[model samples]
Target: NAGVTQTPKFRVLKTGQSMTLLCAQDMNHEYMYWYRQDPGMGLRLIHYSVGEGTTAKGEVPDGYNVSRLKKQNFLLGLESAAPSQTSVYFCASTEAGRAKNIQYFGAGTRLSVL
Candidate 1:
Protein backbone atom coordinates (compact mmCIF):
# COMPACT_ATOMS: atom_id res chain seq x y z
CA ASN A 1 0.00 0.00 0.00
CA ALA A 2 1.22 3.49 -0.74
CA GLY A 3 1.70 5.10 2.65
CA VAL A 4 1.31 8.64 1.40
CA THR A 5 1.54 10.27 -2.01
CA GLN A 6 1.54 13.90 -3.11
CA THR A 7 0.49 15.15 -6.50
CA PRO A 8 2.38 17.44 -8.85
CA LYS A 9 5.76 16.60 -7.34
CA PHE A 10 7.01 19.99 -8.53
CA ARG A 11 5.28 23.24 -9.42
CA VAL A 12 6.11 26.81 -10.40
CA LEU A 13 3.54 29.47 -9.75
CA LYS A 14 3.59 33.15 -10.60
CA THR A 15 2.69 35.56 -7.84
CA GLY A 16 -1.01 35.41 -7.02
CA GLN A 17 -1.60 32.17 -8.88
CA SER A 18 -3.46 29.49 -6.99
CA MET A 19 -3.06 25.72 -6.77
CA THR A 20 -4.15 22.69 -4.82
CA LEU A 21 -1.94 19.91 -3.62
CA LEU A 22 -3.44 16.51 -3.04
CA CYS A 23 -2.34 13.92 -0.49
CA ALA A 24 -3.45 10.35 -0.15
CA GLN A 25 -2.62 7.59 2.29
CA ASP A 26 -3.59 3.98 2.54
CA MET A 27 -2.59 3.35 6.12
CA ASN A 28 -6.05 4.04 7.50
CA HIS A 29 -4.66 6.67 9.80
CA GLU A 30 -6.99 9.00 11.62
CA TYR A 31 -4.78 12.05 11.89
CA MET A 32 -3.48 13.84 8.83
CA TYR A 33 -1.50 17.05 8.56
CA TRP A 34 -0.04 19.53 6.11
CA TYR A 35 3.27 21.18 6.87
CA ARG A 36 5.68 23.52 5.14
CA GLN A 37 9.42 23.33 5.52
CA ASP A 38 11.56 26.36 4.81
CA PRO A 39 15.32 26.60 4.74
CA GLY A 40 15.86 26.81 8.49
CA MET A 41 12.59 27.29 10.29
CA GLY A 42 11.83 23.57 10.48
CA LEU A 43 8.46 22.10 9.63
CA ARG A 44 5.50 24.32 10.48
CA LEU A 45 2.01 22.95 10.54
CA ILE A 46 -0.43 24.57 8.12
CA HIS A 47 -3.57 22.54 8.79
CA TYR A 48 -4.71 19.18 10.14
CA SER A 49 -7.65 16.90 10.47
CA VAL A 50 -8.29 14.52 13.30
CA GLY A 51 -10.63 12.44 11.23
CA GLU A 52 -12.53 12.37 8.01
CA GLY A 53 -14.77 15.42 7.55
CA THR A 54 -13.08 17.44 10.27
CA THR A 55 -10.50 20.16 9.66
CA ALA A 56 -8.67 22.67 11.82
CA LYS A 57 -6.22 25.52 11.41
CA GLY A 58 -2.67 25.05 12.52
CA GLU A 59 0.37 27.10 13.51
CA VAL A 60 0.94 28.60 10.03
CA PRO A 61 -2.51 28.43 8.55
CA ASP A 62 -2.41 31.79 6.84
CA GLY A 63 -2.77 31.78 3.03
CA TYR A 64 -3.71 28.12 3.13
CA ASN A 65 -6.79 26.01 3.60
CA VAL A 66 -7.34 22.28 3.94
CA SER A 67 -10.05 19.69 3.68
CA ARG A 68 -10.39 16.01 4.59
CA LEU A 69 -13.41 14.57 2.86
CA LYS A 70 -12.32 10.93 2.71
CA LYS A 71 -10.59 8.75 5.25
CA GLN A 72 -7.53 8.41 3.07
CA ASN A 73 -7.19 11.85 1.54
CA PHE A 74 -6.31 15.40 2.54
CA LEU A 75 -6.09 18.41 0.27
CA LEU A 76 -4.33 21.74 0.68
CA GLY A 77 -5.31 24.81 -1.26
CA LEU A 78 -3.38 27.99 -1.76
CA GLU A 79 -5.75 30.71 -2.86
CA SER A 80 -3.15 33.37 -3.57
CA ALA A 81 0.33 32.04 -3.81
CA ALA A 82 3.27 34.26 -2.95
CA PRO A 83 7.03 34.02 -3.07
CA SER A 84 7.08 33.54 0.66
CA GLN A 85 5.04 30.40 0.12
CA THR A 86 7.75 28.90 -2.00
CA SER A 87 8.82 25.96 0.12
CA VAL A 88 8.61 22.20 0.37
CA TYR A 89 5.21 20.93 1.41
CA PHE A 90 4.87 17.65 3.20
CA CYS A 91 1.79 15.71 4.10
CA ALA A 92 1.94 13.42 7.07
CA SER A 93 -0.27 10.98 8.91
CA THR A 94 -0.37 9.10 12.18
CA GLU A 95 -2.72 7.20 14.35
CA ALA A 96 -5.15 9.54 16.04
CA GLY A 97 -4.18 10.50 19.57
CA ARG A 98 -1.82 7.56 19.86
CA ALA A 99 0.88 9.18 21.92
CA LYS A 100 3.32 6.45 20.96
CA ASN A 101 2.82 6.90 17.23
CA ILE A 102 5.15 8.94 15.08
CA GLN A 103 4.19 10.67 11.90
CA TYR A 104 4.96 9.20 8.50
CA PHE A 105 5.61 11.78 5.78
CA GLY A 106 5.19 11.87 2.05
CA ALA A 107 8.05 12.48 -0.39
CA GLY A 108 6.98 16.14 -0.50
CA THR A 109 5.96 18.62 -3.15
CA ARG A 110 8.35 21.37 -4.18
CA LEU A 111 6.67 24.66 -5.01
CA SER A 112 8.27 27.83 -6.28
CA VAL A 113 6.40 31.08 -6.48
CA LEU A 114 7.89 33.95 -8.45
Candidate 2:
Protein backbone atom coordinates (compact mmCIF):
# COMPACT_ATOMS: atom_id res chain seq x y z
CA ASN A 1 0.00 0.00 0.00
CA ALA A 2 1.36 3.38 -0.90
CA GLY A 3 1.91 5.07 2.44
CA VAL A 4 2.03 8.61 1.09
CA THR A 5 2.79 10.06 -2.34
CA GLN A 6 3.18 13.64 -3.56
CA THR A 7 2.79 14.87 -7.12
CA PRO A 8 5.47 16.74 -9.06
CA LYS A 9 8.61 15.83 -7.14
CA PHE A 10 9.99 19.20 -8.23
CA ARG A 11 8.56 22.44 -9.57
CA VAL A 12 9.65 25.95 -10.48
CA LEU A 13 7.29 28.88 -10.51
CA LYS A 14 7.44 32.61 -11.09
CA THR A 15 6.75 35.09 -8.33
CA GLY A 16 3.03 35.16 -9.08
CA GLN A 17 2.17 31.78 -10.51
CA SER A 18 -0.13 29.44 -8.67
CA MET A 19 -0.17 25.68 -8.29
CA THR A 20 -1.73 22.87 -6.41
CA LEU A 21 0.24 20.03 -4.86
CA LEU A 22 -1.51 16.74 -4.50
CA CYS A 23 -1.01 14.23 -1.69
CA ALA A 24 -2.45 10.79 -1.33
CA GLN A 25 -2.26 8.01 1.25
CA ASP A 26 -3.61 4.51 1.38
CA MET A 27 -3.43 4.04 5.13
CA ASN A 28 -6.95 5.39 5.69
CA HIS A 29 -5.56 7.73 8.27
CA GLU A 30 -7.93 10.28 9.70
CA TYR A 31 -5.37 13.01 10.16
CA MET A 32 -3.41 14.56 7.29
CA TYR A 33 -1.03 17.49 7.35
CA TRP A 34 0.99 19.72 5.03
CA TYR A 35 4.33 21.09 6.17
CA ARG A 36 7.20 23.04 4.72
CA GLN A 37 10.85 22.46 5.55
CA ASP A 38 13.33 25.27 5.27
CA PRO A 39 17.11 25.27 5.43
CA GLY A 40 17.78 25.00 9.16
CA MET A 41 14.33 25.26 10.68
CA GLY A 42 12.29 22.18 11.40
CA LEU A 43 9.14 21.32 9.53
CA ARG A 44 6.44 23.99 9.88
CA LEU A 45 2.83 23.01 9.55
CA ILE A 46 0.91 24.73 6.78
CA HIS A 47 -2.46 23.07 7.00
CA TYR A 48 -4.12 19.95 8.36
CA SER A 49 -7.33 17.96 8.27
CA VAL A 50 -8.67 15.93 11.10
CA GLY A 51 -10.81 13.90 8.72
CA GLU A 52 -12.43 14.01 5.34
CA GLY A 53 -14.45 17.21 4.78
CA THR A 54 -12.75 18.92 7.71
CA THR A 55 -9.82 21.31 7.38
CA ALA A 56 -7.93 23.63 9.68
CA LYS A 57 -5.24 26.26 9.44
CA GLY A 58 -1.82 25.43 10.77
CA GLU A 59 1.14 27.34 12.13
CA VAL A 60 2.14 28.77 8.75
CA PRO A 61 -1.08 28.81 6.78
CA ASP A 62 -0.73 32.18 5.18
CA GLY A 63 -0.54 32.21 1.37
CA TYR A 64 -1.83 28.66 1.25
CA ASN A 65 -5.07 26.77 1.36
CA VAL A 66 -5.97 23.11 1.76
CA SER A 67 -8.79 20.72 1.04
CA ARG A 68 -9.62 17.23 2.25
CA LEU A 69 -12.67 16.15 0.32
CA LYS A 70 -11.49 12.57 0.10
CA LYS A 71 -10.35 10.45 2.97
CA GLN A 72 -7.13 9.48 1.25
CA ASN A 73 -6.31 12.73 -0.41
CA PHE A 74 -5.25 16.15 0.85
CA LEU A 75 -4.48 19.00 -1.51
CA LEU A 76 -2.49 22.19 -0.88
CA GLY A 77 -2.90 25.20 -3.12
CA LEU A 78 -0.75 28.25 -3.47
CA GLU A 79 -2.78 31.13 -4.85
CA SER A 80 0.22 33.33 -5.46
CA ALA A 81 3.58 31.75 -5.30
CA ALA A 82 6.45 33.84 -4.03
CA PRO A 83 10.19 33.38 -3.73
CA SER A 84 9.76 32.90 0.00
CA GLN A 85 7.47 29.98 -0.74
CA THR A 86 10.35 28.07 -2.24
CA SER A 87 10.85 25.15 0.09
CA VAL A 88 10.39 21.44 0.47
CA TYR A 89 6.77 20.51 0.97
CA PHE A 90 6.01 17.34 2.84
CA CYS A 91 2.68 15.61 3.31
CA ALA A 92 2.08 13.54 6.41
CA SER A 93 -0.65 11.34 7.81
CA THR A 94 -1.35 9.63 11.10
CA GLU A 95 -3.97 7.56 12.82
CA ALA A 96 -6.79 9.50 14.41
CA GLY A 97 -6.19 11.02 17.85
CA ARG A 98 -3.09 8.92 18.32
CA ALA A 99 -0.61 11.53 19.39
CA LYS A 100 1.89 8.81 20.23
CA ASN A 101 1.88 7.62 16.64
CA ILE A 102 4.48 9.19 14.43
CA GLN A 103 3.34 10.78 11.18
CA TYR A 104 4.25 9.07 7.93
CA PHE A 105 5.65 11.55 5.43
CA GLY A 106 5.82 11.61 1.66
CA ALA A 107 9.16 12.02 -0.04
CA GLY A 108 8.54 15.74 -0.64
CA THR A 109 7.84 18.31 -3.32
CA ARG A 110 10.62 20.78 -3.95
CA LEU A 111 9.21 24.08 -5.18
CA SER A 112 11.20 27.05 -6.37
CA VAL A 113 9.52 30.37 -6.93
CA LEU A 114 11.78 32.65 -8.87
Candidate 3:
Protein backbone atom coordinates (compact mmCIF):
# COMPACT_ATOMS: atom_id res chain seq x y z
CA ASN A 1 0.00 0.00 0.00
CA ALA A 2 1.13 3.59 -0.53
CA GLY A 3 -0.55 6.09 1.74
CA VAL A 4 -2.16 4.47 4.74
CA THR A 5 -5.20 5.76 6.61
CA GLN A 6 -6.80 4.52 9.82
CA THR A 7 -10.29 5.29 11.04
CA PRO A 8 -11.59 6.04 14.53
CA LYS A 9 -8.74 8.20 15.76
CA PHE A 10 -9.76 7.58 19.38
CA ARG A 11 -12.01 5.07 21.12
CA VAL A 12 -13.01 3.97 24.60
CA LEU A 13 -14.31 0.48 25.24
CA LYS A 14 -15.50 -1.30 28.31
CA THR A 15 -14.15 -4.70 29.24
CA GLY A 16 -15.51 -7.43 26.94
CA GLN A 17 -16.58 -4.97 24.28
CA SER A 18 -15.19 -5.32 20.79
CA MET A 19 -14.37 -3.15 17.81
CA THR A 20 -12.71 -3.25 14.42
CA LEU A 21 -10.09 -0.79 13.19
CA LEU A 22 -10.03 -0.01 9.52
CA CYS A 23 -6.84 0.63 7.56
CA ALA A 24 -6.81 1.70 3.96
CA GLN A 25 -3.98 2.40 1.55
CA ASP A 26 -4.04 4.22 -1.72
CA MET A 27 -1.43 2.26 -3.62
CA ASN A 28 -1.23 -1.45 -4.01
CA HIS A 29 1.38 -2.97 -1.74
CA GLU A 30 2.29 -6.58 -1.13
CA TYR A 31 2.85 -6.32 2.58
CA MET A 32 0.69 -4.71 5.23
CA TYR A 33 1.03 -4.83 8.98
CA TRP A 34 -0.53 -3.70 12.23
CA TYR A 35 1.34 -2.54 15.31
CA ARG A 36 0.61 -1.20 18.76
CA GLN A 37 2.67 1.20 20.84
CA ASP A 38 2.63 1.26 24.59
CA PRO A 39 4.06 3.83 27.00
CA GLY A 40 7.60 2.47 27.38
CA MET A 41 7.97 -0.41 24.92
CA GLY A 42 8.49 0.02 21.24
CA LEU A 43 5.94 -0.89 18.59
CA ARG A 44 4.73 -4.48 18.75
CA LEU A 45 3.36 -6.32 15.76
CA ILE A 46 -0.20 -7.48 16.06
CA HIS A 47 -0.79 -9.01 12.66
CA TYR A 48 0.36 -8.86 9.04
CA SER A 49 -0.50 -9.88 5.53
CA VAL A 50 1.82 -10.93 2.76
CA GLY A 51 -0.68 -10.32 0.00
CA GLU A 52 -4.36 -9.95 -0.65
CA GLY A 53 -6.38 -12.72 1.03
CA THR A 54 -3.46 -13.89 3.18
CA THR A 55 -2.78 -13.06 6.80
CA ALA A 56 -0.18 -14.24 9.30
CA LYS A 57 0.19 -14.01 13.00
CA GLY A 58 2.67 -11.53 14.43
CA GLU A 59 4.55 -11.03 17.70
CA VAL A 60 1.46 -9.90 19.57
CA PRO A 61 -1.40 -11.72 17.90
CA ASP A 62 -3.37 -12.68 20.94
CA GLY A 63 -6.81 -11.11 21.27
CA TYR A 64 -6.56 -9.71 17.77
CA ASN A 65 -7.26 -10.81 14.21
CA VAL A 66 -6.69 -9.38 10.74
CA SER A 67 -8.19 -9.65 7.30
CA ARG A 68 -6.93 -8.56 3.88
CA LEU A 69 -9.71 -9.37 1.47
CA LYS A 70 -8.74 -6.48 -0.78
CA LYS A 71 -5.38 -5.27 -1.99
CA GLN A 72 -5.77 -1.81 -0.53
CA ASN A 73 -7.58 -2.50 2.71
CA PHE A 74 -6.68 -4.26 5.95
CA LEU A 75 -8.91 -4.65 8.96
CA LEU A 76 -7.85 -5.24 12.55
CA GLY A 77 -10.47 -6.70 14.83
CA LEU A 78 -10.51 -7.09 18.57
CA GLU A 79 -12.72 -9.95 19.69
CA SER A 80 -12.92 -8.42 23.12
CA ALA A 81 -11.40 -5.45 24.84
CA ALA A 82 -9.31 -5.37 27.95
CA PRO A 83 -7.27 -2.85 29.88
CA SER A 84 -4.06 -4.49 28.73
CA GLN A 85 -5.15 -4.05 25.12
CA THR A 86 -5.38 -0.29 25.38
CA SER A 87 -2.73 1.32 23.21
CA VAL A 88 -2.01 3.36 20.11
CA TYR A 89 -2.55 1.22 17.04
CA PHE A 90 -0.76 1.82 13.78
CA CYS A 91 -1.14 0.49 10.27
CA ALA A 92 1.65 0.31 7.75
CA SER A 93 2.31 -0.98 4.28
CA THR A 94 5.39 -1.41 2.12
CA GLU A 95 6.34 -2.58 -1.28
CA ALA A 96 7.72 -6.09 -1.20
CA GLY A 97 10.29 -5.67 -3.97
CA ARG A 98 11.83 -2.45 -2.68
CA ALA A 99 15.36 -2.70 -1.32
CA LYS A 100 14.68 -0.21 1.45
CA ASN A 101 11.27 -1.73 2.27
CA ILE A 102 10.22 1.69 3.43
CA GLN A 103 6.82 1.52 5.09
CA TYR A 104 4.11 4.17 5.10
CA PHE A 105 2.30 4.51 8.40
CA GLY A 106 -1.17 5.71 9.30
CA ALA A 107 -1.86 8.47 11.79
CA GLY A 108 -2.91 5.83 14.33
CA THR A 109 -5.91 4.79 16.39
CA ARG A 110 -5.86 5.38 20.12
CA LEU A 111 -7.90 2.81 22.04
CA SER A 112 -8.65 2.98 25.76
CA VAL A 113 -10.25 0.00 27.48
CA LEU A 114 -11.79 0.69 30.83
Question: What's the residue-level lDDT of 91 in candidate 1?
Answer: 98
Give the winner by lDDT: 2
TM-score of each: 0.96, 0.96, 0.95
In candidate 1, how many clashes are counted?
A: 0
Which of candidates 1 and 2 reaches a greater lDDT? 2
Residue pair clashes in candidate 1: none
- Please rank every candidate by lDDT, starting with the best: 2, 1, 3
**Per-residue error (Å), model 1, residue 43:** 0.5
- Where model 2 places Cα greater than 4 Å from the true spot, the runs are none
Q: How much lDDT does each candidate structure score?
A: 0.96, 0.96, 0.94
16-52: candidate 3 lDDT, tens digit per residue: 9999999999878889999999989999999999899
> What's the TM for model 1?
0.96
What RMSD, rounded to one decimal, does every model reach? 0.8, 0.9, 1.6
Q: Give the Å shift of residue 26 in candidate 3.
A: 0.5
Better of 2 and 3 by TM-score: 2
